[model samples]
Target chain A: MKGLLIKDFRLMKSQINFFIILTAVTVVLAVFSDNPSFVPGYLPFVMSVFALSTISYDEFNNSSAFLFTLPVSRTGYALEKYCLSLILGAGSWLFALAVTTVSGMIKGTAVFSETAAAALIILPFLFISVAVMLPVQLKFGGEKGRIILMIIFGAVFLIFVTALKTGEAIGNDIQAISNPLSGVNLKALFAGAFIAGAASLLISMKISCSVMNKKEF
Target chain B: MIKTENLQKRYGNFNLNCSFEVKKGCITGLVGQNGAGKTTVFKALLGLIYPDGGKAEIFGKNITDFTPEDKEKIGAALSDSGFSEYLTVKDIIPILKALYKSFDEKFFIRQGEKLGLPLNKKIKEFSTGMKAKLKILVAVSHKASLLILDEPTAGLDVVARDELLEILREYMEEDENRAILISSHISGDLESLCDDIYMIHNGKIVLHEDTDVILSDYAIIKVTEEQFKSLDKQYILRVKKEPFGYVCLTDQKAFYAENYPEAVIENGSADKVITMIIRGQEA
Candidate 1:
């Protein structure tokens, strides 16, 4: 597993310039945006997408077939991808939040607790997104998997757009719908989602293992 | 050290059902043309492909039960698909170290330099021969007890091919218990190195012979129509008709030489033996 991680990280070196550019754009957006909450999720979400691209790297030139012949097992290979995703996702999530909080403090525009809460809320979605993308990339491969990624990316975008609303009515429309169910508690709903996210992430890892084991090459 | 019992795989029209073994202290060669199922056999043994119906064992254990340590002892280099082309040799050393406890960094680096493989260049920029050399070097660096290599000498010039074969020979020499099962389209490579060879054609093991026997005992007999009519057919394995008469492949070279002193006979080679087995009709 360590070897596989090293290989993935080394592969990532080929696109370091692109990632650096992405980090710069993310920093600029977080520092300049009025609603800093949206900036935190934005960077982490984009970083998670980059994490998934490692699978495409492995699939290119049919390298996966030789990769599996190494000492690593299929289950170990699947688990390593999740580990990589978590490391990248959590690391960027913290970086984005740090910039948001520091910028907010300099301008006297933010409370740390409120900002932290909003950012924490995105962690589960980040995991769920990873949970969904890993198996799709494993099963469908890079070529067809790109289409699925776009669809899933679109869905995640909609979720973020609805959560922020941006003076538009996407979230307000949801608020209006939930008005009738006001008796439902928001805290319990969030707790339920957190558990579901963790569970689905595990199940997705298992599915990726099966996909790898059944693969011919 | 490796054995398979009727390992079977079917890909639409091609069906692979082969039984072969590579004993300790031997370099076993699997020789065949493209689409002849050599790669299928290698993949099955390596657990890269699940055999539809059959069993295989390595190091006296079933392939299904191979623990990580067991796999660590077996190094494989396939003709297709290796370390991603995006990576450089410098990047592979640390990864190999992390993966194999026995990986020798000094040896790998030394071989990389010795082979003229640039350490810092991404593999995508490597020429075909360079890539082939890298693949074999990676396999042999870990001190594996067994090696499964497919087309290891495919794209090398004669000198590079000889250098690559010497590396393989040195690897086997280090541990007398070591064994290798390799395949190549270039029969000269195998004929010069292998102790024995298996001829696989149309997804089957058509012939198995010691390299020495194939060279010394086996002979091609070219006879005119009148001569072939009276020739004994029991020793012939395969026969092809020619414009003048027939070309017969026989293992008993001495019998034909003594009985038909006037008949035309030529020494057998790996290429001629494979061509006869694959293209000639059964005698």
Candidate 2:
């Protein structure tokens, strides 16, 4: 496992450095800007792109044969990609947190507790992106993989926007199905996120492993 | 040791139905013309492509049954493929060392110097001959029991080819248990190195014989039309007739020599046998 990690790290050292620079810039911008909502929103999306690039590297370089030759199992390879993404996602959230804290401290504003929110919101998105990308990477390789990713994400984005507009049109007329403790609770949301993320990651890893295992070189 | 049982691979128009074995401690050469299933065989053995039918086993383990542990004992290189171009010889060594359980770093570095592979330079920057040399170096450096090289000396000059073959010979001497399977279109490399030869065409093994037997048993006879007419059809495996006379490909060299002492008979090398087989297929 450590060997696999080292291999992945070596493969992505330059990309990781690029991301760190981007993260630093984002951190600086979020700290200086007056918007707290925008800080959390963009971080997860950027982190997802970073995760996607790893697949791109594998495809572009024809690294599959090389990676498969290594002592690492296919299952280990799939799991390692997911693990790396989650680690990076966590780092992104933490960086965002630091930015928010610094921004709030500088402006003399009361800070909201964001620990639960970070875990709930960021982790699931990262895992889902990973889940969607792994199978595609296995099937189409990295280059075409990213193009497929963009198309799928684009269609989802269009549907999401339409749903938002429809929700606005039917505003307040639709009686919310309210129940005791049915409101958005950050704690419950975090638990749900963890469960969903874990499930998707596990399923994705399984699928990726099978695909990789069957792949010849 | 490597073995294949009716191994079949189909890629739309191209199909490879090959079966042969490289016995332990002997170099088996796969000799074929360009696009004659050399690379396909290597790919199938490495489990780089799923065979449509049949089986491939390396060191007694089927590719399907192989875990990561099984790969450590095998070292392979395809004809026109390699590590990423972004890597230099220096970068590639560490990566392969980490992957293969028995990677000999010192051996690799020494071969790198011997083969004239520039360590600091990226692979993309190297010449084609240099790249070929690098791949061969990697395959020989590993503590692998089986080394599968596909056109390992393709683009090399005479000097480089000799150097590379010499290095391979040294590597082979280290362990009596080790074996190698080299595929090359050029016959000289195989003639000098291989113990047994497998001649392939259109995805099938046309001939599998010992190197010495192939050299001694086959003969190419150039004779007049009358002499060719007089020759027994049973002795002639293939005949390419020109306007001048006939060029006969025969398996029974001694019988033909003794039977027709007056006929113009020339002893054929392994290269001529392969050529005759190819011409026979063409005809």
Candidate 3:
């Protein structure tokens, strides 16, 4: 598993740099807008793109067949990908927070309290998206999986837009984004997301193992 | 040693049903056209893909039973994939050393120096032949009981191919029980390196025999079309009719030569046998 992680990190070096640069740019813009909440919501979606690049690496380089031949188990490989994606997304979030804090200090006003709110709210959604996208990437390769990803996001966007336009009271049922940490129940949300992420990870592992195991070369 | 019993797999458009045993201390060559299940066989043996039916066993244990400990004894290089292009030979060596208990870093370094593989250069920057050599170096450097290679010399020059083969031959001196299985469409390499040959067509193995047995027992007979029509069908495995003559492949070459002294009998190798079988299928 360690070997697999090392390999993935090397493969993802370019994307890692891109991710850092992207966060820097996003932070600058969010600071200028004086809306810190925007970073967390927007960062997950952008980081998802970078996460997609990792899967693309395996497909483009034809490394799937080779990596399986090593001593690493299929289960191990799947776990590594899931863990890496989570870590990468989390790392990007932290960096954005740091940048946002620095920018907040630069400006006189105490702004971006919403940004912390957004991170807490958006983190679970990111987990769900990753958990969903992983099996698709494993089942279908990069190109087809990317198309599926776009379709899924587009559908989600349409639903979100429709809900807003209808003036739905869905927001009332959901926890308020005020006070970032104090307004919401952190324990329950964390537990739920952890369980959801774990379940989704297991599903992804099973799918990847079975699909890869049955592949003929 | 490796064995497969009625192993089968279907990849939608392609299917494979291959069964063969490779003994220790001998090089076995798998010869097949593209998409004839050579790579599939390699994958199945390494447990990369599960068979739809049947079983694959290495060293008498089922492939699925392999733990990381068992995997250390085997090394392989598939043609379509190898080490990641992002890793340099230097980085790869250390990773492999850490992964495999029996990884011989001294041998790896020696081979790298000997082969002129750039230690700091990423694989993406290397030529196809160089990449092939790098894979061979990694696979061969390990102190393994078996080496599985799929088209390892596809893009190699003549000298490079010979050098690789020579290194493989030297590996034989390290351990008398060591074995190698190499699959290639190139007939010349198999003719030189393998002690036995297996030919695959479509999804089935068309022929498997010792190299000497194939060389001596199989013969290509040239006959007029009329003669071909009159010839005994029992002795002929396949007959290819050209404009002027019929090229007939026979298993009972000695018997046919004794019976038809007037017909021209030419010696045949494993490659000719596979080609003739493919031609017969086309006809």
Candidate 4:
């Protein structure tokens, strides 16, 4: 597992310029934009995408053939990708959060508790994003994997929009559904989301392992 | 320390069923033309792909049960696959260090430099000879008890091939129990390095013989159609029709030399043995 992680980090180092540019853009957005989502939500999702890129690199040049022959099991290879996704996602989130907090304080618009809440909320989003992306990429790799993920995202957006339209036609209260009761336990809600995200991640890892184990090369 | 019993894999019309072994302290060669299932056999042994049926054991454990620790004892260099080209030699050092518990970093670097492989250059920038040498170097430096090399000398010049062969020679010299199972189309490389040879064709092993016996005892006897009809045929293994009557392949060179003084018999090389077995009809 350590070796696979090292190889991925080494592969990522080849894209160092891209890493620098993305961080620069995120920092600029965090300092200039008023949106709290700019820090934790945007950066981590992008970092999770970086984790998926490592999979493409492994597939390139048929490198997976040599990689599998090393002292690494297929299940371990799958597990390492998930661990890497979490590491990259969580690391970038913490960095973005710190930058956002400092910039907000300097701009005299700082609310520590609110900023903390937004950053904390994005953790679940990061986990869920990883849970969805890892298995998709592992199941269908390289160009095929990317195309499939795009279709998945498109289908999901269409389904969500259709559900909203159908609800309006049925005369359901959109505002009530969109904004839950003010009396609802806010802490409990985020906690429940976090738990759900964690559960999904475990299930996704299992599926990814099976996909890798079943892979020919 | 590697054995397979009727290993099988199927790809549509092509079917691979082969049995072979590599004993400790020996260099075993697998020779076959393209699409003859040599790569499939290597991939099966390395666990890069699963076999449809049969049993394979390495170091006395079933290949299906092999763990990461067991894999560490093996070093493999495939013909068409390797580390990603995006990585430099320097980038892979740490990765290799982490991958193999017995990896010798100092030895690897020293050998790389000796072979003129640049530390900063990505593998994509490497010459064919450089890439080939690096693969053998990596396989040998990890102290693996078994090395599975598929076409390690495939694209190299003669000199580069020799250098890579010397590396394998040194690898075998360093450990008494280490074994290497290598596949290459270049018969000279195997002729000089392998203790035994297995020639595969049409998804089966057609011939397996000790290198010494093949080189020293195997022979090709050219006989006229009249001589072939009247001559003793007990020793002929395969026969090919030729413009000059027929060519008979036999391992009993001396027997033919003594029995037919008028016939033309040439000493066997790896190339002749493989060609006759593949192209000639079984006698």
Best by DockQ: 4
**Tens digits of lDDT, candidate 4, B1-283:** 9999999999998899999999999999999888899999999998989999999999999999999999989989999989998999998899889999899999999999999999999999999999988888888888999999999999888999989999999999999999999998767779999999999988899999999999989999999999999878888999999998999999999999998999999999888988999999988
Rank order (by TM-score, best first): 4, 1, 2, 3
lDDT of 2 by residue, A21-130 (tens): 87787777766776664566567667755655666665554656655544556777777776777666677777777777677777776355653354347667767777
lDDT of 1 by residue, B200-270 (tens): 99999999999999999999999999999999999999999999899999999999999999899999988
Q: What interface Cα RMSD is found for model 2? A: 2.7
- Per-residue lDDT tens digits for candidate 3, residues B147-226, read 99999989789988988888888887899899999999876677878899999988789888888878888899889987
Report the C-alpha lDDT of model 2 over B116-147, residue by residue, as the tens digit: 88888878799878887787777777788888
Off by over 4 Å in 1: A152-173, A178-190
Q: Which structure is stronger by lDDT: 2 or 3?
A: 3
Tell me how far the alpha carbon of residue B81 in candidate 3 is from the true structure, in angstroms, after superposition: 2.3
> RMSD per prediction, one decimal?
3.0, 3.1, 4.3, 1.3
Q: List iRMS (one decimal) for every candidate.
A: 0.8, 2.7, 1.9, 0.7
The lDDT of each candidate is 0.89, 0.76, 0.79, 0.91
TM-score head-to-head 1 vs 4, winner: 4
Pairwise lDDT winner, candidates 1 and 4: 4
Give the higher-lDDT candidate: 1 or 3. Answer: 1
lDDT of 4 at B102: 93
Docking class of 2: acceptable
Candidate 4, which segments miss by more than 4 Å at Cα? none
Enumerate the candidates' DockQ scores in order: 0.80, 0.40, 0.44, 0.87
lDDT of 1 by residue, A1-217 (tens): 9999999999888889988998887778778878878877877777777767888899889898888778988888889999999888899999988988988888789988888889888988988989999899888988798798789889988988867686345445666767776777867767877898899898998899999878778
Error of 4 at A58 (Å): 0.9
Candidate 4, residue A65: the lDDT equals 90
